[model samples]
Target: MDTDIFSLRGRNIVVTGAAEGLGRTFALAFARRGAFVACVDIDPAVEETCALIEKNGGKALPLMADVSNEAAVTTMAAQLEASADTLHVLVNNAGIAIPPGRLLDVSVANWDRVIATNLRSVFLCSKALLPMLLRSKDASIINLSSFLALVGLYPGFEITAIPYASSKAGVDGFTRQLAIEYARDGLRVNAIAPGWHGGTRLGRERQASSEPAVIKRFNDFIQGSIPMGHMGTPDDLTGLAVYLASSASRYVTGQTFAHDGGLTAA
Candidate 1:
């Protein structure tokens, strides 16, 4: 089988939240396939991602900005526009999750923060980059969603905050709406809904904030819930990400693909 269809040679891609976790993995993977990646994040560690890509003989640019802030995203767009003439792919991977707790106990501040980071950033970055993306013959936007967006946790099995789920659900809606609006422009919009992925800062944050008993229960849920009987690593999503970002999925859009180890299937 010819693999050239999956090649991203000479493509210009931007990945937000690329300082670590899934974002870093996506940035490196795209660079390996010959794409010039712009690694964007509010964290200074974003430079480390660029260094890794450069060390591997791949081209990368690091940009720091608060994706949830309009002014910051605008400035990031300006920086990117000045550097590249066109954008082939954009990965809206910046997101955060507050600690799990009763909905009644959730604060308005936390709710707004999750919505801004997870949902609003998708809108901000996509809107800011649309002009550049439109310049590409094959443009795609990949949004990071979650299994929680599609299904709610069982009672006593809640490991994620309600705001996290709500924000991801909003992303799914945004992906579909934006795809339809831009189909005539030859732009593809899609989302990746991952389930129980370990080694991510989001998971680590939850673990650090929860009590020992809560952590034990969450672990039990992970062990017993997924049909494949294991949590996934960030590397597990790289292939699907590349597929969505490449010509291989040229005909695919407005869809959310799950990489859940059969957790969603079960």
Candidate 2:
């Protein structure tokens, strides 16, 4: 059991949506493992994430850009290329879920916005960064997906947005196709489909917009559905992320792993 296989020493990595939540967690985890992390986000708060990494004796760079915007992504790629000769890993963790509602009740503008932010951003970032990624001996692209992509919620729950679910499904398809296309080049593409995680902005936004009774019902239903009987935290996904970014999973590619509290199984 040589644990050295899990080391990410000297590797260069990029994590989008790193201003907060799971993206911040992934950036910190990689930096702690001795990887040089570039924390990218549209929010200026991304500097805070980099500050924390530096506080802990880790190397980090904060880059501001809207990943959903092609021009912005192109600029970000250029900045990254100037900073590093090659990129070892890319965590496509930037995504947004609009307010939860039924399909017909949702507006067309919101639907398109979700798609652009969640699905299109993955494409833009990967395409812009392909050259840098290809230069690495071992490159991996880790896309953040959600369990909602695989199954629909109970009717009238309004616990999940239609556009959000659809965008994540697209991410899965993109991951599989890209994985096959780049396998010959030794670039692995994979997705992590998280379920019912607490302490994220998504959960908070949903709660803030719902009535007390609706919130209670949503919470009760979620708790009852998960076999583990509890929601996960951002920390729960860190280990899986590290595994995917490290050589420990060099042979793995084009797979979507559910980090649900056994919700997907039950």
Candidate 3:
């Protein structure tokens, strides 16, 4: 009954790959809602994410690091300790699309790279921050997965890669195991599987086509495919992210909530 149960005021949150796209959106959303956001990205643009937050009257810290590197992740944890004694939320959003190739075509090296980027980074970051999260009264870890993990949908996707799908599926599995291991610590681990958006690989297909007619064709395809009659926006996910990061979801743990406008349902 208390509406304030979702407030993120005074909480310190870290979001990886916050330089742009969904990661930037999540960082800004949390900062606007009153949380001190630590924007982490391998790109220098991560500083821009921090500036945007500060410009909006929110607190932010810019951290540049490769999430896949254990040492870099450990440094982030140490930085958090220096900036904020506790970490309330961690959103592991750094990921990449492997070369578009079938299982047989995908090289062993590419396979390892995809695993390192998509799955290993989540483990390294979560492991590094576990102690800090455990020290908090309420802590949450959100792993970014994909609807492809749910239904193996990729033909229409712009970022078509066999490894991409495989890696996301692994994220789903990792989230489940971590949730169980840390449940007693009051650390809730979960994942979000996003649907089509306008900027991602698939999203760009509808925008940067060779011709207007081709672009319209792609748009029509998605519109007809999704039950919602369209795709989703970054803002469309903010509420769910806020819920899982707040006390509102204290009773929830070890779950992967798909935000794909029924893409996986159909």
Off by over 4 Å in 3: 1-3, 154-159, 200-218
Ranking by TM-score: 2, 1, 3
- lDDT for each residue of candidate 2 in 122-159, tens digit (9 for 90 to 100): 99999999999999968999999999988888645677
Q: How would you encode candidate 1's per-residue C-alpha lDDT over 71-114 as one tens digit per residue?
A: 99999999999999899999999999887776986999999999
Cα deviation in Å at residue 86, candidate 2?
A: 0.4
TM-score of every candidate relative to the true structure: 0.97, 0.97, 0.91
Candidate 2: segments with Cα more than 4 A from true spot: 1-3
Tell me which residue pairs clash in candidate 2.
none
- Kindly report which residue stretches of model 1 are placed more than 4 angstroms away from their true locations once superposed: 1-3
- Cα lDDT of candidate 3 equals 0.86
Candidate 3 residue-wise lDDT, 21-127, digit = tens: 78999999999889999999899999999999999999999999999999999998898789998999999998876544566778888888888988999999999
lDDT for 154 in candidate 3 is 42
Candidate 3 steric clashes: 0
lDDT, residue 15, model 1: 100
Worst 10 residues of 3 by lDDT: 201-210
